[model samples]
Target: MNRRMAVPEQPLLRVRNVSKIYGRSCGECMEGTGPERESNICPKCGSIVAGGPISFDVYPGEILCIVGESGSGKSTLIKSLYFDDTFSSGEVYLQNYEEGKTNLLALSSQKKRRVRNCLMGMVYQNPQLGLRLDFTSGGNNAEKLLTADWHHVGKIRERAQELLARTEIPIERMDDCPKNFSGGMQQRVQISKALANNPSLLLLDEVTTGLDVSVQARVLDLIRQIQRTLGITMIVVCHDFSVIRMLTNRTLVMKNGRVVEAGLTDQILEDPQHEYSQILINSML
Candidate 1:
């Protein structure tokens, strides 16, 4: 009997040595900045290394969390992944995009727009960034669908209604502007809008920040439900360990624009190996 080897699953998203620099580099930028250097700024060139040499793989349907204090560059890393801010160097590949042969950062603006609209979704910490304050909640979702080429008004409306309901928004409030809704409601609307296209990957950057504790719990529960039902991969950037523990299957601990630790979420929480990760876990208690 001949036995064949099983093929390994490919990552849905792959990032390698990705870095975003804010100023001109002195050729020693990476060498001078990182966790060991205790800084994200290059002393020789005065460049702010917002993030990178960051490398990680996100498997399909897995929820990965990036945790760090303010200025740890976790948010910057997520934003760069979405092309909200251009990264200075590195390769990013999506398995479904160009067969993972193309580096996303090298794509043209038009192609990047296509990727953003079709393959990926983002939920920002602030609803204002993700939603049109003056547009009706349904209208905001329609805008996203429209970008993805959903032209039929009736079908668009139907999809919008479905998403709103899924996110626990009242169907009657579909016509209401996000600005008029409570913060938690606004975030729910944002989530619905981001999910309008049924993106393969979702990027959530502190989505529960600033909400009441109970509201946060509801929102987090909604997210968990969505992931369970849709099997969508997610990369969540959050400073709170509790949120990370609640949501992520795996975790990355970042400091000074670099990842200091990466492992199973429960394992990392139970026994953080890095000093900064230990400090973070301690602070959570």
Candidate 2:
């Protein structure tokens, strides 16, 4: 007797044909540019196609990494997903929102803000972008919680302490300003704040960049720990393949505003098929 197979799990987040363009598009922009053309610039329209026609799905509790060289559009793709910059075209759906039937891009600003505060979190490469240096570490966490409709000061403070401890930020330092903390500590605080609402999805962009090697290791470990403990889905963008290997289950190699290759992290690292991916992997070696 044949047995019924289990249904595939729905993606926590789905992105379709997303693209971001700078300057007036000429329709031929995508056609005329990319890794094939050795540029993200359109020869005909002089517009930069910073990202797109990119698509992917992130499953629940999975860590997906987008790895690329500078100008490869990895950063643009991440920023677009976070709504830091509007995409010129494409659709994004979250399984937690409207059963993944709604195009998030079509939502009003207020609705988008609610989605960000309630369903998603972002950690930028520069701690300054994710943190208000002058705010005490605990205050930063409270701000996120408040945006997510968290009231009650005592509960907020307690939650802040818990998150700070989870991220390995000393509980004693929760009331101190992040501006005075070391680079790693500031990132820990940022991570705590992003996790304040226990978002189902977290986006991290070059998070360990510019940190000392030891500090980067600690931060990376903290990220892994958080994901394991919280079971949060994550999309991480970075130029560093090592970081991808360390944290991601799947990987996308992007170049010239396009995804050149994607697969399990170990598979891509060991036997990349795309020429660009091969070059990238070789360079890392």
Q: Candidate 1: misplaced stretches above 4 Å?
A: 1-8
Candidate 1: tens digits of C-alpha lDDT, residues 78-180: 9989989988999999999999999999999999999999999999999999999999999999999999999999999999999999999999999999999
Per-residue CA lDDT of candidate 2, range 1-285, in tens?
011222248989999999999999999999999999999999998999998899999888888899989999998888888888899999999998999999999999999999999999999999999999999999999999999999999999999999999999888898999999999999999999999999999999999999999999999999988887788889999878788778888889999999999888888998999999999889986
How well does each candidate superpose onto the true structure, as a TM-score?
A: 0.96, 0.96
Which ranges in model 2 have alpha carbons more than 4 Å from their true place?
1-8
Q: C-alpha displacement of 52 in model 2, angstroms? A: 1.5
Note the Cα lDDT for every prediction shown: 0.92, 0.91
Clashing pairs in model 1, backbone N/Cα/C closer than 3 A: none
